[model samples]
Target: MKTRAVRMYGEMDLRLEEFELPEIKDDEILVKVISDSICMSTYKLAKQGKKHKRAPQDIDVNPIITGHECSGVIVQVGEKWKDKYKVGDKWALQPALNYQGKLDSPGYSYRFCGGDATYCIMPHEVMELDALLPYDGEAFYQASLGEPMSCVIGGYHANYHTNKQNYNHAMGTKKDGNILIMGGCGPMGLGAVSYGIRFENKPKRIVVTDVDDAKLERAASVISPEFAASKGVELIYFNSSKENAEEELLALTDGHGYDDVFVYVPFKPVAEMGDRLLAFDGCMNFFAGPTDNQFKSEINLYNAHYTSTHILGTTGGNNDDLLEALQLAAKGEINPSVMVTHVGGLDAVADTTCNLPGIPGGKKLCYTQFDMPLTAIDDFEELGKKDELFAKLDESCKAHNGLWNPEAEKILFAHFNVEI
Candidate 1:
């Protein structure tokens, strides 16, 4: 089969080319990728190439495909796994294969098996580790977003509280306790905020801090304070760039501090601020990853020993977290669409991945079968003046409170005469 994908040749060297894929083995499956959400980790991989720990060293010779967070329909099922999986089944990728204790993963180490392609092969190890998840969501984009949402869910699950009577640790955030999410307004941070308010063990209050007022306002417009209040949780947004930011943030909790604090930015000050805001026995999760190898932050050791404050970090989600995210999204309990602000085609993947940080907005979702530039949903109206397709899409999104939805995706595909 012939597949077109973005392949990384070296550091910042990605090419969008067409190649013939070898016939799938009996133990492997073939899929037609529909949607893929760009991730920061993929940007890091493009920057580091062979130097990335999870990336193969021989990318210069045999280039590897460049994407991971993806979802699609199964086109062909291998005979070895026909009983467990069949053609036309929708699947989301977990990507953390953890196969045989190696750093290798789908997007970074595979040649014919990655998300940024019209078609790709799913190796046997993907099913062996249960990394290829079955998805029944209404939209393919939601399934693609499940991977990032799982990371947010994993951060919450990784937090622990201690029992004074015993040495064991109680998993998960403190139920009905005060929670703080620092630097919360980006894509992943927004997912964390949504999960914080909607999770079964909802927090008493959630305080989100960010430097940008526009972003904070946009976040509130979607996941409003009223919405959180309906769920028996108080939601507040604070600007963290002020001179008295720390003092003002602490006052929001009535001086009791936060029981669960999440740092969504890798800046040292943000990490240190999260440390100071921890209540007695409070758990802090450093959710954002830093690109620098020598990144460091100061922690109050006295508080750690005397106040029972501690911190931990998580990079990816496990099978359980992925399943939870998918179920919640499918049930309409959580809206992963809030994280997607832009959409494009496979032709836009390389440029979008390379300049992801420079671009403003949340997730950039790519549809694999067409050729379109990366376009923001917020700009639909302006683009609509020139094209009627975008006009219909803009009207559809505006009807749904300006957020991307299944109807908008259908309109986009229908305009192109695509059957998806």
Candidate 2:
């Protein structure tokens, strides 16, 4: 049997290739991938190539399939696993292979295969453990959102402010505390906003900041309206690129700063801004992961000491967090659909990851399979058209001034073919 996969050939180069599927062991099951969301971490590694710590260190380096967030139906269960997972059961797979007591999992530490393919083999331990959640969603994209949402839950449960003596504090379940979502236009950042507004009882004010006006507008249209007027949950947008970003944030908080600040961008400058905007007794959760060996920051120690500010970093999710994220997504408490700004099949992913990050707003989602075959195309051709296309898109975005609409999807999809 043949499978399609996105292979990382070198720095800034990933190609979709066809490969032969491995025979499944009796203790394993074969899953036909339904949908996959491109992870920011995966995009970073693909761009960095050899510099990535998680990249396999072996001869078989080229053609390494690259995807992590994925959901699929159990198509072929092995003999011993027949009773454990039925052939038609829909489920999501957590790419972390370390759940079986190994130091690392297949997708992360080695070239064990990933979800950007037509089919994958799940080990017994992965099927029974890790972040796999049963799926009953209306679309495959919703199911695939589990991984990103799970990571958010992990950050939420990291107990960021609860550990330090002076800085230890909680945002509580009430809506009185102020929460700032840094880089609020990205996928994880947007997810944090949804969680804060919907589950945290509509915080006093849910402030979202991003350099891109389009993304900030997108967040307001989709997330802000969910809160009731009485909750006093206001969605405010700030351009982090401005010289007065800190001053603006302080003004929003009545000069006190935000109670909880979630840092969703890995850029060093963004991190510093988060630390500066943190309110006294505030907890700054570094929700995004920096690249390997790329630490860059200069914080004010005096301010931290006097204000009792806290900083914390977290990555990957535990099983419990995944469960909560899945439940929240299942109930529509969190809307993953609003954040999906781009969608395509396997062939479009390499280009999607290469350019999506540079785009001004919204999460670019890649569909593993599509109802119709997308014409095969090259990345260079797509990149060549980006300048012209981006201009038109930007104009439309400015005219609406960040309104949420399905038209953005049409614009993005029109630029890329969606076949493998």
TM-score of 1: 0.99
Q: 55-167, model 1: which lDDT tens digit per residue? A: 88899999999899999999998899899998999999999778889878888999999999999999999988888889988888999999999999999999999968999
Q: Estimated TM-score per prediction?
A: 0.99, 0.81
lDDT string, candidate 2, 57-81, tens digits = 5414544677878877877878976
Question: RMSD to native for every prediction?
Answer: 0.9, 6.0
Judged by lDDT, which candidate is best? 1
TM-score computed on alpha carbons, candidate 2 = 0.81
| Candidate 2, poorest ten consecutive residues by summed lDDT | 371-380
